[model samples]
Target: MNNDIPKAVALRYDRELEDAPRVIAQGKGDIAKRIIELAIENGIPIHENPGLVDILMDLEYYSEIPEELYQIVAKVLILVYEIDKKYTSNFNNFLEQKGGANT
Candidate 1:
């Protein structure tokens, strides 16, 4: 793959729903752009790991990530969790500044 074009892989994980994270989507170039755009539009966190993406790209869509990647993926998940926590904090602060949530 050309390094000039961006690559992306989207993983979906739900502890009660699946044993491991699945590759919900993967693409390069235009498809990759759309994958990223959708993630941004839906407020999903994005992490960059080109080597990991390369390995994941070899896996079939909707397949669980391999055992070998568990540690690496776990780190990514931790980062995503932190990102979510920060975003939630900022959003709550924004709401409080505006006189708290309506509900």
Candidate 2:
């Protein structure tokens, strides 16, 4: 087996939360779902093979994650999920503020 990770794998590691919106929006399902799907499609093996939903849920709540020799992938996913959640929260707050202003 080739020990070297593919270019795509390295690229995924380099992603930051700031890029979440565009990347997530480009996928087929919800942000997290689409991310995992894309990873699998690209042949980045997530060891333990847990379902995508479970992985997403863990990232959302615990903020703690499993250990892996190649942890950069998981870190990237967590960062994106956090950015997505924060954006959603901020948007909701903005709507609430606007509603109060009109009243």
Q: Choose the strongest candidate by lDDT.
A: 1
TM-score winner among the candidates?
Answer: 1
TM per candidate: 0.92, 0.34
Q: Which ten residues in a row have the lowest lDDT in candidate 1?
A: 94-103
Cα lDDT of model 1 by residue, 1-103, tens digit: 4798999999998999998999999999999999999999999999989999889999999999999888999999999999999999999899898885465
Off by over 4 Å in 1: 100-103
Candidate 1's displacement at residue 80, Å, is 0.6
Tell how far residue 85 is off in model 1, in angstroms.
Answer: 1.2
Candidate 2's displacement at residue 97, Å, is 0.2
Alpha-carbon lDDT, every model: 0.93, 0.43
Taking the tens digit of each residue's C-alpha lDDT, what string does model 2 give over 5-98? 2212112233354322121112223554555577678655433222332333333232323343235445555676677677779989999999
Model 2: residues with Cα > 4 Å off, grouped in runs? 1-70
